[model samples]
Target: MDCIANLASEKAVVIFSKSLCCMSHAITRLFQEQGVSPMVHELDQHPRGKEIEMALKRLGCTPAVPAVFIGGKFLGTANSVMTAHINGSLNKMLKDAGALWL
Candidate 1:
């Protein structure tokens, strides 16, 4: 849990992801398209990946991968991100987190 927290706080926007997950890819692309350079941690390639995944599971991430954090706060899974985007709050969050200047 401490590891997860530390990693999440390392940047304005952090995405805990698996390199090949399509959802993770899409979410990353979305942020990039918006000109937000999020810090992406590929869990499958991390040494303590499983431990982090379990921690994310405890935090209620159903699929574990693609867990997101903004401004050191947990923002949840792919659905949550997509919903925030659809509701027009995603850009606000990005700006607030300093991941977007526009």
Candidate 2:
């Protein structure tokens, strides 16, 4: 959890994800499509992934993987990202938060 927080703090955009998760892949694709290069942390591949999972649950995510963060803050899950994209606010949010220059 500390590592996760540290990485999030260091990066403009961060994604805590599992490599094999479709939602995670979708989130990654979404950012790429928008020209944002996020720092993706594949928790499932890490030794402390389960600990991170527990930490995410504490952070208020139900299904924690694919959690998004911007400006060192918890943003939301993939569903939130999708909703933000559909409503046309994700791009603006990313731009305003300095996650995307575009």
Candidate 3:
């Protein structure tokens, strides 16, 4: 639990995703397009799934695949991420996360 928190805390941006999800893929591509190398953790492959379980519990959310975090703060679902992009907030969020220069 502590280790997972530490890892999450260390990264400016972290995206927990399932490889099969289209929304997840889209977000990944968007980040790539912007040249942001977000720390990605695939929940399906996570050895410490319990740690992620606990983190999601802390956020009052059921462990749904593709949880995104910016500067260690939960930013909700992929649709929310896309909405952020559509609304022009995603770029600012990425910049704040140090994932982009502009």
Top candidate, metric lDDT: 1
Candidates in order, TM-scores: namely 0.97, 0.91, 0.79
- Least lDDT summed over 10 consecutive residues: which range in candidate 2? 3-12
Model 1 per-residue lDDT at 8: 95
- Which has the higher TM-score value, candidate number 1 or candidate number 2? 1
Better of 1 and 3 by TM-score: 1
lDDT of each: 0.94, 0.87, 0.73
What are the clashing pairs of model 2? none
Candidate 1 lDDT over 59-91, as tens digits, reads 999999799999999999999999999999998
Residue 23 in candidate 2, Cα distance off native in Å = 0.6
Clashes of 1: 0
Best prediction by TM-score: 1
How high a TM-score does candidate 2 get? 0.91
Q: RMSD in angstroms, all models? A: 0.6, 1.3, 2.3
Candidate 2 residue-wise lDDT, 38-68, digit = tens = 9888998888888888899898888998999
Clashing pairs in 1: none
Better of 2 and 3 by lDDT: 2
Instruction: Please identify model 2 stretches exceeding 4 Å from their true place.
Output: none
